[model samples]
Target: MVRKPVVSGMFYEDNADKLSSQIEDSFHSEFGPGKLPSKKRTREIFGVISPHAGYQFSGPGAAWAYREIAESRPADTYVMLGISHSGFPSCTSLEDWETPLGTVKVDKAFQAAFMERSGLKQDETAHSQEHSIEVQLPFLQFVNKEYKDQLKIAPIIISEEQRCKEIALSIAETIKQTGKKAVIIASSDFTHYGMNYGFFPFQDNVRENMHNLDKGAIEHIKSLDADKFMGYIDDTGATICGRLPVAAAISACRILGAKKAKMLQYYTSGDITHDYSSAVGYGSLVIE
Candidate 1:
């Protein structure tokens, strides 16, 4: 029953009514394709990689994945691996994510398995204000009606560490061992823009390098090559905060017999707001 509020009212609407409507509107707005291959080629998805930014910025990209989930309506459980902004030393942190809609329960059985597999301690304190995962709930409420009562999540907050892959692999293995229907959601935002975020290598320009960098990294992800992905991160220093989660999800999908990934949508806030000086990148990808 421990609930965390994280990025409430800032990343998303705080009010339930407003949040619900906004998410619905965003879901309806997704259209067109991107640098990735057509979605018509990929199989049904086991899960998705989505941005956790505000509704105005990344909501549409996030919705493409959720919309696929809604249309398919997969069963079993959901495990959301999100970035830990708390700077905790923990390899993985787990807790219940709360929003105006309702509390999404933690699947205790899966949680116990994850704890044993990852050997990571639970820190409810870290989950209290971690926005990365919590922001996705309102969209879930919009997409999945069955989620209202049965929704359960294994919320894991990952940190930057030498053994990130070890922890990620263990968590993924635990999910596989469960032998139940489930979906893995990775919450992440690609590239923070402007000097305030200190990653202005492009100097607020809408050049192709920014897009290419993300495309290359995402290509590695699509191939389910975690080692190559880690190498890319080391080489390019791409500013994706949820790399760990995406890595874990890709690994888990491969283990679960998922063959490939398809990019559903990609966009930057600049495309919507006409402010290239500072923008956050958003993308949606699915593994089948």
Candidate 2:
């Protein structure tokens, strides 16, 4: 089974040539890394935190994470984590994911193991409307030459925030049992501000306050402290779209021996749209 691209031509380009060019431009964009990913991969990456928004608004920020990923030693599987409708529970899919770049197979071996170990169910429909996971695939396709055609993912759409630590333990154990070198990718956007989002924590000095707000969450994430991260979210009502998945990622990374995380990039839609009134904050970080 194949899950076709859902956000193409909107969140990103529908045409392959143009989409590829758009990604290239994002790498060189003023908000982006200002250069392409390196040809060589010598570093090791345990996991990453990426924002899942339209390319124009969050692509540059995402490029920072992908640039580091592109240069890291490849993983046998990328465990993609996303958030679905509330109360959906954590779920995985066996269907291959299709994007403009092409289709990437789901690592069924890991999928089965993750389910078996975590007791998470397999449900394809849960991912149909979620862009959080789909948005990261093209970036994966764009950066690596070695795994271009052979890329594999273990796609999961999580909904239960309370069971994140338990689910993460299962994932970490599954990776160890299967001997699959893997990278956990948690897709999320931070701080959905403005009246549109119904979240106005601060009225004045948004540019400064927004950074202060998200940086607090980033500090917790960088320390790989899922408790503090989620606690911060609860305390502040940060409006982070995929907070649970990010918590899972941080938990799993910690279990997998991730020492620390480093912030790769940070920007707000206010910075892009020039409308601080209603904006979302995007932050990218790598756990190593």
Candidate 3:
């Protein structure tokens, strides 16, 4: 079964040519407060945390992470851990995903291996309308344009935060024993602030407070402290959409021997819309 694109026209361009052009533009665009990082050859880039908002808002940040992945060329398979916005079950899907660019084959072999080890169910309902993982496909397609057929995906929706460590261990063990080189991607956006998300912890210095809140979570992620990441989220009630997924990726990356994580870019929708009244944060990071 092929999982059709649900947010194509809404979150990104639906036309093939337009979508490709938009992605290429995003790659060429400057990110953060400076020029994007120059591409450098690196070894063993195991994981990345990428935002899943619209291409116009989060695309530059996403490009920074994808550019790093393109430079490293870590693996043939990408394990995508996405938050379930549709409130679906926590599971993995073994169905090809359709995007404006083309269809990305599902790595059934890897999915089976992971499910066997983790005891997670295989369900497509969880992925039916989820946009988090879907939005990242175009970037991967553009980055791997030369080897599009060589790329495969294992998409997993994370619903249970408490099971993250166990799931990560199982995934790590499966990859190690199978000798399959893979990269993990956590799809998340940070701190939905203002009355929109009802997460108003501060009335003054809203932008500064949001940055500090998100930075605290990023610090735990950079440290590869999964427990601390989760604890920080729970204690602060941070409105990070993919805290569980990020924690799982951190745990898996730690098990895969990844030491340091580098923040590629950080910004919010407010930066784009010039409306800080209601904002959502986005960040890009790579674990090595």
Give the winner by lDDT.
2
lDDT of 2 by residue, 13-125 (tens): 99989999988988999889999987888999899999889999989988998998898989899999999844566789899999998989899999998899988888878
Please provide TM-scores, in order, for all candidate models, with all chains considered together.
0.89, 0.98, 0.95
- The backbone clash count of each candidate, in order, is 0, 0, 0
Q: Specify the poorest-scoring 10-residue window by lDDT in model 3.
A: 32-41
Predicted structure 1, TM vs. truth: 0.89
lDDT of each: 0.75, 0.90, 0.87
lDDT of 3 by residue, 1-288 (tens): 799999999899999999987877777766632333345546569989999999988888888888877787647789999989878767999999999999999989999998999989988888888999999999888777777888899898888877888888987888797788899999999999999898888888877888899999999989999898889998999999998889989899899999978888888888778788999999899998
123: Cα error in model 3, Å: 1.1
Clashing residue pairs in candidate 2 are: none
Q: Residue 76 in candidate 3 has what lDDT?
A: 70
Best by TM-score: 2
For every candidate, C-alpha RMSD to the true structure in Å: 3.7, 1.0, 1.8
Model 1: ten consecutive residues of lowest lDDT: 32-41
lDDT of 1 by residue, 118-167 (tens): 87778777777677888887776666555578877777777755656776
TM-score of candidate 2 on Cα atoms, chains taken together = 0.98
- Which model is ahead, 1 or 3, in terms of TM-score? 3
Deviating ranges (above 4 Å) for candidate 2: 85-87
Off by over 4 Å in 1: 30-44, 91-95, 204-207
Q: What's the lDDT for candidate 3?
A: 0.87
